[model samples]
Target: MSATEDPAAETADDFPAAPPLPWRLDGSARLGVFTLAQPMEAPSTVTAVAARRLLVFANSYRGGDVSYDALGVATLARHRHRVAVVPRHLWVDDPSIRRAGREQASTPSDPGSFAWSDSSARIASGQASVELSWHVRTRLALPMPMTFTYFVWDDGRLGCIPIPGRATGSPITMRINHWPDHFPELAAYESSLALRLNFAMTVRPQRLIDSK
Candidate 1:
């Protein structure tokens, strides 16, 4: 991951006028591995392995409205790109959060519906849904720091942001069941590097990068 942000992309676009400088969020996430689809970011280099992620925010009511934010993400390998794609840009449950995300981070969103239990969860999209059930054995639990750069798109401008945070990661084994036709991006994955986390981070201001 890139350790620092580009000064040029730092203060560009409408990010300076976003709802807030940084949003403090705490949640749990599951990262799953899938088959690498052909024609990746780079044509010359051969690569394998891809990531699909699921995240849930039980409570994010800084303003006093209980909004459950659940997201489905496709974390594609960026080859050698400086700006990487991270989670929370694919599918989301809350419309309010969607509106804020579009302006703040250049995120494209899908309407979501969710249901969950202690051991199982489901996130429903338009016509497709993802069902996850896990019998998890927490082998490790430690304070972890997260650092990643996200590249997003708005109109024609490519936006970027660095999200740095701290969390306690509890890894798990999850069984995911889905139709192949619906989610071709992710293969039928029973387990991968999955984590249940309690995290807190102040989201950084967005940056619009120079294409050339």
Candidate 2:
């Protein structure tokens, strides 16, 4: 036997407590991280870890690259979430629908011009998860016959799947018990760096709600 305590036996008390909600990052370098508050403007730094905390404040409603009046989300190593920010593009290809065009104020009817909003665990499970959801208001038509996908954390592994109904709407539903064993290496590479969201909707949704 040695005369030292086992380092692995340390309890929660051994480490410093985590900061409460709306806490500052303090001094961590925000290089690859991004926060979207508008579709055509720039994203503001809500919390910067430069010193203690960098709290970003805004009242413009919309400033980042999103389609709604207000667009904002928090991205961190631990978690992330979003509300009212529609995804402009999807990195992974889904077999449910075909790309018509891109989102634009000029080409409203072109499918290629529209991006389907999505959800995230961080954004939905606010306690300690990334809950991402992009609301498309009551005017624009849904991307009918589309499928949304949600990618969960795989201990730094890459993966993708259909967005569950809970993350999307009542008519849709999905569940994932474990991570895929063989996700494409290309996607896995990106997952190691950051979390991304992609959504699919009907080009003609019957009941678009203004949850905002």
Q: State the C-alpha lDDT per candidate.
A: 0.53, 0.20
Candidate 1 per-residue C-alpha lDDT over 1-212 given as tens digits, one digit per residue, 9 for 90 to 100 = 11112223323342333355476665666554444344223112212223333222222223312234564544443534563654432555655565566656766566567777887777776676767776668657889886666666556565567778777877777676653243434433665456666666666878866443
List the candidates' TM-scores in order.
Answer: 0.71, 0.17
Instruction: Name the lDDT of candidate 1.
Output: 0.53
| CA RMSD of all predictions | 8.2, 22.8
Tens digits of per-residue lDDT, candidate 2, 15-107, equal 433222211111101011222222222123111121211111011112122122111222211113321122222211111111111111111
Global fold similarity of model 2 (TM-score): 0.17
> Which candidate wins on lDDT?
1
Best TM-score goes to which candidate?
Answer: 1
